[model samples]
Target: MRYFLKRFGFMALTVFAVCALTFFLMNAIPGGTAELILKHTFVGLEESATEEQLNQISSRYNLDDPLYIQFFRWVKAAVTGEGIGTSYVFRKPVLYLLALRLPATIQLAGASMAIAVLAGVSLGIYSALRENRISDHILRVATLFGVSMPCFWVALLLILVFSLKLKLVPVAGYGSLENLFLPAAALSLHSMAAVMRVTRTSMLETLGQEYIRFAKAKGLPLRKIISRHALKNAMLPVVTVIGFQMGNLLGGTIVIEKIFAWPGIGSLLVDSISARDLPVVQGCVLAIVSMFLLVNFLVDMLYTHLDPRIRYG
Candidate 1:
């Protein structure tokens, strides 16, 4: 209970800090909040809007209040579930926009994470079993290549090969599974590489353990020894890597989303940033942070199950 409480408290604090920083930074930018809101609200309105109109709009939105007061007001409303506020660009509730886009983001993240975990763990196990052989060496080189490649470059190259030349997938825009392959593959590459490397290292270390030798000497079949003993024991580090990669994939999907037009929260975040839509930006950040925290919390629980020594207390 104490450990969980402490972690939950930290997550709350992190969320508050992110919200404050996001709000302050958004306001501190060159454009005025009132002007941006009014301009976006009324299509034809521009910098030339009269002072009287500005005051009215500011007063209506409580934007004319002192900075600290505005912050507190927004925070209170947000915490109480009244809402963070409307988008400065879309003139709609920020949550509404997020709700619409969240599923698409979930789809991409899920697909990419599935790919990373499945292929990464498989490759890692194979490499460890073959330790120092030609296949292992080749796998290591591929892992290095994945880790070194920039995401955008990977995305572009995949598009060129699969979408443009091979006609195997769509270059951009989202709809069906065919539309998702190139982007998900691009997004999973780095994570898959990280997982593969970690798993290989962890599995190798576990396989080298004295207990592994005992299991082998006890007349256990090679398959049973590897599966029931080696892989199970080796999973702790791999779990940690997967947990971290899951959070990263959720946030990092922004680039892939933008490139593929996947309409995920990451793409929404980028659009909100470009438009200076602070509410939307804040909402997106809050959502991402919440997701990451949730994943870590689950991973923490998983630790106790994976390793009996990891007690909550």
Candidate 2:
């Protein structure tokens, strides 16, 4: 309980700091903040939105107020769930726009993580059992390739082979399960390699332990020994990596979404930034930060279940 409370408090503080930083940084762009916002909001208007319109926007959002006051006001509005202000570009409620795009992002991230864990853990166990053999070396090389390549390149390569050459899946766009395959594979490759390496190293170490040797001496089945002893112990570090990678998946989705035209929060954030839609950008950053913090907290809670020796005091 104590640890949970402490973590919760820290998460709140982190969210506040992140939101404040994003807000201020956007306001500090080279051009005058008000002028840039006005230009983007009224690109269709003659003379970059008249002074009368600029005054209306500023007064309405209290943009002319000191930075601290503006920050607090926006924070209050956000917390109360009343509204997070309208988007300068979309002319829709920031929260509403986020709500629409969030599910797509969640779906993509969840699929990618699932692929990473299932494939990575299985391969890791296989490689560990083989150790220095030909198969193990091959997998190690493949993992190096996975980790060394950038995600955008991975994404394009997947598209080239799976989509363009084989016609196995659509080139891009999202709706059905087919649309998910390429992006998820692209997004997951790096994490999968990471998990595989960690799992293999941990498994090898665990297999060399006294308990494992004793279990072998007792004529225990190799399968039983591995399943009951080695795999469980090896999983601790793997779980930690998975938790950290889940947060990273969110950041990765930005590029993946844009490349695939997936219409997730990443694309929304990109568009908002380009248009100087401060409210939408702030809301997206807040949502991403909050989600990342919550995932880490949940992962911490999961430690007690994965290892009996862990205690959160």
Candidate 3:
């Protein structure tokens, strides 16, 4: 309980800091969300972008308030679930915009992580069982390639092969399983590489342990020994890799979403930043931070289950 509480406290503090930093950084820019929205993003409103109108819009949200005051006000509003304010660019409730796009982001990130774990973990086990063989070396080289290549390039390459050449999936846009395949696979490749390497190394070490050698000397079937001893014990570090990579997958979607034209929070965030849509940016960031923290917390909880020796205070 103490450990859980302590971590929870830190996560809370980090969230508040993220909120404060995002809020201040957005306001520190020369123009306000209202001004930018009126002048740039919502250019259609430019005709009516009078000084009085701008001030009224700003005051309506109390944007003119001192930074501290505004920050506290936002915190209150967020805690109570009243509202997170509205987006200047979309002219919709910030939470509403998040709601609209969150599912797509979840779908993309979830799919990516799934691919990472399924392929990476399996391949990791396979490679470890065949360590020092030509196939193992080949997989290690491919893993390095996957880890080294940038996501955008991978995304484009997948698009070129699947979308452009084979026409097997979408070139861009989101919705349906078909639209998800390329982006999710592209996003997964890096994480998959990372998880695979960690799993292979961990499994290799675990297999070299005295108990593993003892089991081998006994009449225990190789498959049973692997399933019961090797894979289970080797999962600790792989779990950590999956947890951190889940967060990365969420954040990485910003670039991938734009490339694929997927209407997720990441793409929304990028567009909001471009338009100086402060409220939307803050709200989007807060959501992302919350998700990242949540995944870490869950992974910590999972440690107790994966390893009987792990105990929390």
Candidate 4:
């Protein structure tokens, strides 16, 4: 309970700080959402609209208000479940636009993380068990390659080979399970590499401990000793890495999303940024930050259960 409380308190403070910073940063950027809207809406009416007409549009969106007042209004609307106002670019409710696009992003992130955890852990354990063997050497080389490759380049290569030359998957735009494999594979590669390294390191250290030797001395089966004892201890650091990677997966999806035409939050952010859609940008940032913080908190709680020595300070 004490650990949970402390973590929750710290996360709350961090969320508040991030929210403030996001708000101020958005405000600091020159030109209001209203101006952006007018630029798009009144493309040929620059000379036709009177100064008063332009001021009216700005006032209608409350863009003329002080920055702090605008922020408070946005917060109030957000808290009261009034939605994320309207986007200057799309001319639709920001929340509605996000709702339309968020699932694709969530699917991408979830699939990537799942692949990373499973593949990474398996490779890590395999490498550890066969330490210094050819298999271990090959796995290490593969992991290093995965870690070294840039996500954009990987994405492009996958597109060029699988989608273009081989025709194994669709080239771009997401739909159905078939669309997920390539982007998920691209997103998970680096995370999988990191997990493999961590798992190998942890397992090696755990294998050296006296308890593992004791289990072996008892004539326990290799599988039982490794599964029940060695792997369990090695999982602590793996869990930490997995949790952090979940957050990274969300943020890192932007480039992959764009490349694949996946309609995830990262892509939405890019689109919103290009159009200067403040509400959409703000809402997406807040949502991503909240998710990142929530995952971290859950991982911290899991640490205590996974390892007895991990006590809350």
Model 1 segments more than 4 A misplaced: 38-49
Candidate 4 vs. true structure, TM-score = 0.92
Per-residue alpha-carbon lDDT of candidate 1 for residues 1-313, written as tens digits (9 for 90 to 100): 8877888899899999988998888788997777766676677876588898889877877777787898898899898999888876777898899899999988888899899999999999999999999999999999999889987889999999887899987789888989988888998999999999999999999999999999988999989998899887898999998889987788679988998888989999998887767789999989888888788788778888888888987
Clashes of each: 0, 0, 0, 1
Candidate number that wins on TM-score, 1 or 4: 1
Model 2 agreement with the true structure over 1-313: per-residue lDDT tens digits: 8887887888889998998899999888876555666777665664656688778878866778998888888889888988987887777999899999999999999999999999999999999999999999999999999888889999999999999999999999989999999999999999999999999999999999999999999999999999998998899999899989987788899999999999899999998888788899998998888888877788777788879999988
Candidate 3 residue lDDT tens string, 1-313: 7887899899999999998889888888885666776677544785668898788778877777888998888889888999998777677899999999999998899889999999999999999999999999999999999999999999999999999999998798766889999999999999999999999999999999999989989979999999997888899999998999987788789999999999999999999898888788998998899988898889888888989999989
Taking all chains together, each candidate's TM-score versus the true structure is 0.94, 0.95, 0.94, 0.92
Q: Where does model 2 exceed 4 Å of error?
A: 43-49
lDDT minimum window of 10 residues, candidate 4: 31-40
Q: List the residue pairs that clash in candidate 2.
A: none
Question: What value does the lDDT take at residue 69 in candidate 3?
Answer: 91
Off by over 4 Å in 4: 42-50, 311-313
Q: Per-residue alpha-carbon lDDT of model 4 for 1-313, expressed as tens digits?
A: 7767877888778876777787788778886556666766777864466677779888878878888998888878877899867887778988888788888888898899889999999999999999999999999999999989998899999989998999988988778888998999999999999999999999999999999999999999989988999987899999999888887788779889998888888998988877777788887887788888877778877888889888887
What TM-score does candidate 1 reach?
0.94
